[model samples]
Target: MEQAQMPGCYRHPGVETGVRCTRCERPICHACMVDAAVGFQCPECVRDGSGTGHSRTANQPRTIAGGRITAGHPHLVTQVLIGLNLLIFLLGRLNPALIDETVLIGFAFDPDLGRVVGVADGEWYRLVTSMFLHQEVWHIAGNMLLLWLLGGTLEEELGRVRYLTLYLLSGLAGSAFTYLIAAENQGSLGASGAIYGLLGATVVLVRRLNRDMRPIMALVVINLVITFAWDGIAWEAHIGGLIAGVILAYAMVNGPRERRALLQGAACALVLGLTLATVVLRTAALT
Candidate 1:
């Protein structure tokens, strides 16, 4: 009988084999054979192909320092949130009429201004809803760009649920703060508050991770300065959102023993209180 053609292991040479390595298509012996998704491959090839390594034991779930589960893409949640915000902003822009006084009054955060005007009136719900709305293309683009750049690292470190909670809570805090600080009968709209919240969360993460935050801090300061210095910018909303974000971030990073869950709960509760107080104050001042 003729000897089977030996092509040698595809990944590692000189080792003669009768069967091919499934990954790299080299011949190998039974000892080097590995069962895989496509077909059998040499152990060396399988290790590289599977990306799990040759000595991969049973599928053991790994836990991080905070007992958070790691997934294939840790930053997916942040991406989705930013995507949704952009989609809403774009959809709102498609028809200029769609983004009217009614829409803005109903959805955007206003300090009971419409109510004082005795026109259609402003709803308290706008505070939370306003975080999802953006006025201009540039506005949405800038916000999403920052989210893409900064949100990934935060989501990876904090996990999806926690990261989302932080983002939303920060937005609420910002909106609430703006309502509280805004002159009664004034209207404000945009996702700048929520974006500022993300920045606040970034500050907390930098401190916790013990990394240099000089660059980020400088960026935040510059942005704040620009917001105040620029025209047509709602500096109040930015300040409010930033304050809320810092508080929410601090709670998330350094809360009690059950820090993650506790901080999340506290953030929600705090937002509710702030919202209610802002509404009451605005209504009283407006009326």
Candidate 2:
């Protein structure tokens, strides 16, 4: 039982394997190889074999992890966040009373500058919790739809865990800002803050990748306009989220090489600290 010797570049034989497809495990020649996010794939197998059995090659581009990866795929974190938001929306619809009693409890902003300066009470969890709650059907729909559009691509670009961290932190930032500015109000809910964060991340990444961002810029401006024009919109949350996103993107995605991961990790930490501080002040003020 001896393994067959691979050809000079083939690495696999008996089937005239020219080069290996990086994505799917198929033998292909230089002529048939298709470049992929992490590596090269055999065009024939990718096209003919239902797109399975992919393997990475050294010649393909590698991330900091030293492997080929996929982009724009929905990572588990994004899926879970989306599911949670939808579930909450459905439950709210089913039990109108639940929505009413819990609306403020679950998603309202509470500012406590006194607490920040050691004078009042606060509820720190609101920074993160507020991200999960939404007020109206259209609110959730718009947020979730934007999340579906931008989150998957971001998760793929940054990998699952990092992407999740960025998203949560951005949401928290949005919530905290709302609390700080609107502490006198009952509270606020929606994914717009987080969605704005995604937009911020996109703008940074697009610039880093050297891709034209005219389209993304246009989209962002349109959303901003809508946010300001619509009385129902939480423009504060959007701005906070956008700021957090830009910071995270700058930290996570500003390098010629594999620095995106490092920047992203740093951004996540910064967001966590800032949002937690806001939450603690708010909670202490409340109590």
TM-score of each: 0.67, 0.67
Q: RMSD in angstroms, candidate 1?
A: 12.8
**Per-residue CA lDDT of candidate 2, range 192-221, in tens?**
788899899989877755567899999899
lDDT for model 1 comes to 0.63
Model 1 lDDT at residue 10 = 43
What's the residue-level lDDT of 218 in candidate 1? 96
Q: Model 2 lDDT vs. the true structure?
A: 0.64
Please report how far candidate 2 places residue 262 from its true position, in Å: 4.8
**Candidate with best lDDT:** 2
Residues 132-188, model 1: lDDT tens digits: 787877877888888888788777656666677767766766666666666544556
After superposing candidate 1, which stretches have Cα over 4 Å from the reference? 1-67, 101-122, 255-260
